[model samples]
Target: MRKDRKNTHLKCCIMEISGRITKDAVTAKVSNDREVVNFSIAINDSYRPKGAEELKKIVTYIDCSYWMGSKMAQWLKKGTVVELFGRIGLNVYNNAEGKALGSLTFHTSNIKILVFPKTENSSSLPAVQKKNTDQDTPDDLPF
Candidate 1:
């Protein structure tokens, strides 16, 4: 029998990023009769250069596409913080002006909402009790 040269130790690459949504998600139908949700996210970072006295903030924008159900688009609104896990993709194309353009894309396999931006009507909600300690609990136990 011939020897098999397949390498079983090869590793796959995975990327995870957390950022705020730049805008609401949009849904579109693909050629395969499937719906996809498209959105953008902005990741911000601050760092001080080698000899700089002050720190500078850098923002990286990434376009993301989700192939799951379109219902998720409704919850992904602007300013919502989300955590995404997926692979990175680079897309190159020509714009309407015939100029070459390139963009970084994140093909997200999984996404989670980290924080929902507070709305003006949120204040109308009732406040929750902080403590439920035994000292404050009623002695009427069914046990």
Candidate 2:
């Protein structure tokens, strides 16, 4: 009884995450012979104005990660503004009191820096390249 052809034929999954970066840390290491960059991105949810009750702005934090690469980890710092496109993965962490803390990981596919972080040791991202070299190499085989 499925009559929706557009929904079945085209598979679309796009998640866009945007917020002020918080608790941003970068650590690159080889764990069990595999290299991975471990980092965290905090997303804050801003509260919308709800009528005339006179409430302050509420903020919520969400922790995310990217396992695809460490380029973002090395280039970001706390309080940096960023927009990201990524997939989601969930993980569980425990504190010293034995309580479980869970987080959703964003495996980054694309990242855009909105603003430089406001810290003394804030990281500097690599500069964007403005060169195109697709026509520099010949496609015809000489052999």
Candidate 3:
């Protein structure tokens, strides 16, 4: 978290999280006809306690909103693994039964798609493309 000069409150709370999209992203229009992309991601983690024979698995879901552009919603499909950089926030509210509940939210500034979900027709898994090293370099060099 980045604080202001006075340190009264946080100016920016930038954080990076990598997770899989829980569902397809949704775009909604707000005041003044502005649009926002909303989505949720599930982060999976596991830990082994001391003197434990098994690992305990945990899953945390965080709601994310992107105000930069709504066009990116098309590519933020379900099961897409992505790395998000943004401000992290927590919303604490009281439930009807007087229980305190807290929810995590991320105001996304940038997104990087890590992996796309497999399609029915595809037999092999998708992978990031690497540069071909077999190609010869041109002799016309400025260096």
Candidate 4:
């Protein structure tokens, strides 16, 4: 008997996460003469057990590598919240003694900044002066 071939293509696994940056992004040059930005995000989860009065918070750290460019590294500062979409992967490497080590990694394809850290002088900008006029302006305008 022959088997059916309706859908032979494997499904892709994409991961999406939103969290705050644990630290500033770092750029590194690979062997292929390409630069990549590496950073980590902290995702906070909270849950209360059945009939519990206190909230329990759990933080998960995700290691991410962005292949877009090093320009994005400047925006990924510590305490900045970001949303990322990418594919999850496991990086496997051998130790000095030939021991295997595996780590959870995320290869980010898209990233968006949600919030940025506030600066001390951000709200101290001088106010701009506007032109004063007594005439009323028309409200009708053409598209």
Q: For this target, which candidate reaches the highest lDDT against the unseen true structure?
A: 3
Give the best candidate by TM-score: 3
Query: Which residue runs does candidate 1 get wrong by more than 4 Å?
Result: 1-12, 94-99, 121-143
* Candidate 1 lDDT score at position 137: 77
- Cα error, residue 63 of model 2, in Å, equals 2.7
Q: What's the C-alpha lDDT at position 74 in model 4?
A: 77
lDDT of 2 at 92: 61
Please, what is the whole-model Cα lDDT of each candidate in the order they appear?
0.81, 0.61, 0.84, 0.79
Q: Write the per-residue lDDT of candidate 4 for residues 8-93, one digit (tens) a residue.
A: 22236777889999988999988577999999999999999899999999998889999987888978888889999988776566
The number of clashing residue pairs in model 4 is 0
Of candidate 3, the 10-residue stretch with the lowest lDDT total is 1-10
Ordering by TM-score: 3, 1, 4, 2
Count of residue pairs whose backbone atoms collide, per candidate: 0, 0, 0, 0
lDDT (tens digit, per residue) of candidate 2 on 1-143: 22211211123376888877775556556676455544455655445476855655655455555556655576667777888887665556565666656646666677788887655542354555668877887898697
Off by over 4 Å in 4: 1-11, 92-101, 121-143
Between candidates 1 and 3, the lDDT winner: 3
Q: Which window of 10 residues has the lowest lDDT sum in candidate 2?
A: 1-10
